[model samples]
Target chain A: MTPTITAFETSPDRGQGLARDMRVRWSLEEVRQPYEVRLVSFAAMKEPAHLARHPFGQIPTYEEGELVLFESGAIVLHIAQRHAGLLPDDANARARAVAWMFAAVNTIEPPILDLQNAKFQEGDKPWAAERMPLVLDRIRQRAGQLSERLDDADWLDGAFSAGDLMMIGVLRRLRPSGLLDEYPNLAAYVARGEARPAFKRAFDAQLAVFTSRQPAAG
Target chain B: MTPTITAFETSPDRGQGLARDMRVRWSLEEVRQPYEVRLVSFAAMKEPAHLARHPFGQIPTYEEGELVLFESGAIVLHIAQRHAGLLPDDANARARAVAWMFAAVNTIEPPILDLQNAKFQEGDKPWAAERMPLVLDRIRQRAGQLSERLDDADWLDGAFSAGDLMMIGVLRRLRPSGLLDEYPNLAAYVARGEARPAFKRAFDAQLAVFTSRQPAAG
Candidate 1:
C-alpha cells in the first residue's frame, strides 16, 4: 500500500520546501517508496481529525493502514529502518547515525527555530530588532560548531543517512536569514543535500504546489 | 558491558537534572540498565577531545566500547532499542513510539528551552519581561495539544515506552514556571512519570549532583 502523508495546503514558507513535510517526502524518495499526500488547510489541521494523527496539529503525519505517525525525524527513521540505503548495516554505525539525527533536530535546530520566532513571527513586535540578533548569534554558535565538525567530511557520520537528511532540512531554515553563507562549509553541505536526486524530487514537488497556488497574473 | 555517558562537573541547572545528560540518565534507569557517568567541567567540554565525541560541545555523550554517540534522544533511543521493555515487538507500534521520541525533542521541547533562555540566559536583557509571555504562549500551545491528545491515555501509546520517558523530561522543564499546572492532564501525566520507581531513582541520582554542589555558607 502507498503510504499517505499530510502536508500544509498553503505552507507558511510558500513552497520553499522548508516545511517539515519536505523531510518526509525526501525520505520517501530516498527509499524509493511510492506515497501520496493529503493536503490540509491550516484550519483543517487544527481540527480534531488531524489532531488525532498529530497531537500538535502539524505536518507531516504518516499513515499506512492502522499505523499512523507524526514528526519528521520519527517518520524518516521509520523509513530508514524499513529500507536499506538510509541506515548503516553495523549496529554501532546505525546507532551513531540515529544519534546525529537527534542532534540535528534537538541540538542544532532549536536556535534556528528561535530565529524563526525572532524573524517572521515576532518581527513586528517592539523587541524584534533587539532580540533577533541575539537569536541569530545563538544560531551561529550552533552552525559554527557544526561547521567545525563537518570540517572536511561530507556527511556528519561515516555515511549519508537520515541524519544528513534531517540536518539539511533544519539548516535550510536559516537560508532566509542569509546567515548560512557565513559558514561556507555548512552552506555547501546544504547544497549537497539539495543536489541529491531524492531531495530534488521533494523540492520540485513542493514548488509545484506553490506554483499552483499562484493565480494567473493576466 | 555497561555504557558510559558524560555529565557536568557543575551543571548550569545547579543539579536540577534539567541538563541534557539527565535525559540520558533517566532513560538508562528506565530500561534497568547499569551505566557509568563521566563528569566533565564546562571548560573541558570545549576542548577538542570532547568536541570530537560531541561536535556541539554538550553533555551526555554515550560511549559503549567502540560505539560512541551524542545527542540525548539518540542515546536514549539506543538504550531503548537494546533493551526489552522500552520498544514494542510490532513494527508499526515501534515506529509510533519512536515518533513520540522525536516529538518530545523537536516539537515539545523547543519553546520550553526558550523559557530557559528567557529566564536564565537572557534574563538581564531589556525585553526579557515582555518577551517571556510570547515564549510561554508557544509552550502552552504545544502543551494544550498534547494534553488534549493524552486525555486519559495511560501513556502516549498503549504501553509506557521511551517516548514517555523523553516527553516527561521535556515537560519537567516547565515545572519551574508552573505552566504545566495549567494543564491538569499533563500535570498528572508528569506526576505519573515521576512516580515511576525508575524515574525516582533517576531524579534522586540527579538531585544528588545538585545537593553536592551547594555553596559553603561559611
Candidate 2:
C-alpha cells in the first residue's frame, strides 16, 4: 500500500526544498517507498478536518492504513524502522544512529529555526538587530560542535541514514543566512545530501509543485 | 559504571526543572539509573574545557565512561535504551515510542521554545506583541492535534515509555502560558506525568538546588 503524506499546496519556500514536507518525501525516496502527497492550503490546514490528521495545521503528516503519524522526525524514523536502508542492523550502532537523529533536531535545529523566526517573523522588531547575533551565535555553536565531530567522517555515526538526511534538512535552512559556508565541511555535507539521487528526485518533485502553480508560462 | 551529567550551578529557571539537565535527570530516575551531577557556572560553560564537552554551553551532558554525549533528548534516549523500563521489547511498539520522543522535541517544542525566545530574548522589541499571537496559534495547533488524538488514551502509544516522558516534558512548558488548559485532555495528560514518582524525584532534585541557593535566614 502506498502511504500518503500531506504537504503545503503552495509552499512558503517555493521550490527551495526547505519545507518540512521535503524531508518526508526524501525519506520515502531514499527507502524506495512509493507514496502519495495530499497538498493542503493554509486555510485547509487550520480546519478541524486537517487538524485531525495533524493537530498543528502543518504539512507532511503521514498515514498508512490505520496508522497515522505527524512530525517529520517521527515519520522518518517509522519509515526507517519499517524499511531497511535508513537504520543499522546492529543494536548499538542503530541506537547511535537514532541518537544522531535526536541531536539533529533538538540540539542543532533549534537555533536555525530561531534564525527563521527572527527574520521572517520578527525582523522588523526593535530588538531584531541585537537579538539576531545571539541566535546566530547559538547556531554557530552547534555547527562548530557538529563540524568538530564530523571532522572528516562521511556521516555522523556511520553510513548515511535518516540522521544524515535530517541533519542536511536542518542545515539547509541556514543557507539563507550564508552562515553554513563559514564551516566548509558542514557546507560540503549539505551539498553531499543535495547530490544524492534520492534527494534529487525529492527536490524535483517539490519543484514540480511550484511550477505547476505557475500560470502555465505561456 | 555510574554516569555523570552536567547541571547549572545557578539555573536561570531557579530550579523549576526548566533546565535541559532536568530532562536527563528525569530520564535517569525513570529508568532507575544512578548518576552524578557536575554543576558548571555560566562562565565555565563557555570555557574551552566545557565547550569541548558541550559546544552549546548547555546543561545535561551525559558522560558514561568513554561515551560522552550532549543534548538532553539524546542523553535521555541513551539511558532509555540501556535500561529496560523506558522502551518496550516489541519491535514495532518500540519504534512508535521512539517516534514520540522525536515528536516531542522536533514538533511540539519548537513553538513553545519560540515563545520563550520572544518573551525573554526579544521581549522589548516593538513587534513582540504583534508576533506573539502567531507563535501562540502555532503552538495551539500542535496542542489541539495532540489533545484530540490523546482523547482518552493513557499514553501516546500503548504503555508509558520514553515517548510519553519526552512528550510530557515538552507539554509541561506550556503550563506558564495556560495554553494546555485550553485543551483539557492534554492538561490531564501532563498531570498524569507529573504524578509519576520518577518525575517527582527529578523535580525535587531540581527544586532542592533552588532551596540550597538561598541564604540562611538570620
Find the candidate with the highest TM-score and give its number: 1
Error of 2 at B142 (Å): 3.5
Tens digits of per-residue lDDT, candidate 1, B1-218, equal 98888988886776667777877887888878898888899899999999988999988899999988998899888888888888889988899889999999999999998999899889999988888889999998999889888999889998999899899988988888989999998999999988988888888887877677788778
The regions of model 2 sitting more than 4 angstroms off are A47-49, A89-92, A122-138, B88-93, B124-138, B152-154, B176-184
Model 1: how far residue B94 lies from native, Å? 1.2
Measured with C-alpha atoms, the lDDT of residue A117 in candidate 1 is: 79
RMSD in order of candidates? 1.4, 3.2
Q: Candidate 1 lDDT (Cα, whole model)?
A: 0.89
Error of 2 at A170 (Å): 1.2
Identify the candidate with maximal DockQ: 1
Question: What lDDT score is found at residue B182 in candidate 1?
Answer: 99
lDDT per residue (tens digit) for residues B134-178 in model 2? 789878877877887788988988899999999998888888888
Worst 10-residue lDDT window, candidate 2 chain A = A91-100
Chain A only TM-scores, each candidate in turn: 0.98, 0.98
lDDT of 1 at A72: 93
Residue-level error in angstroms, candidate 1, position B112: 0.6
- TM-score each candidate: 0.97, 0.86
DockQ (CA atoms), all models: 0.90, 0.44
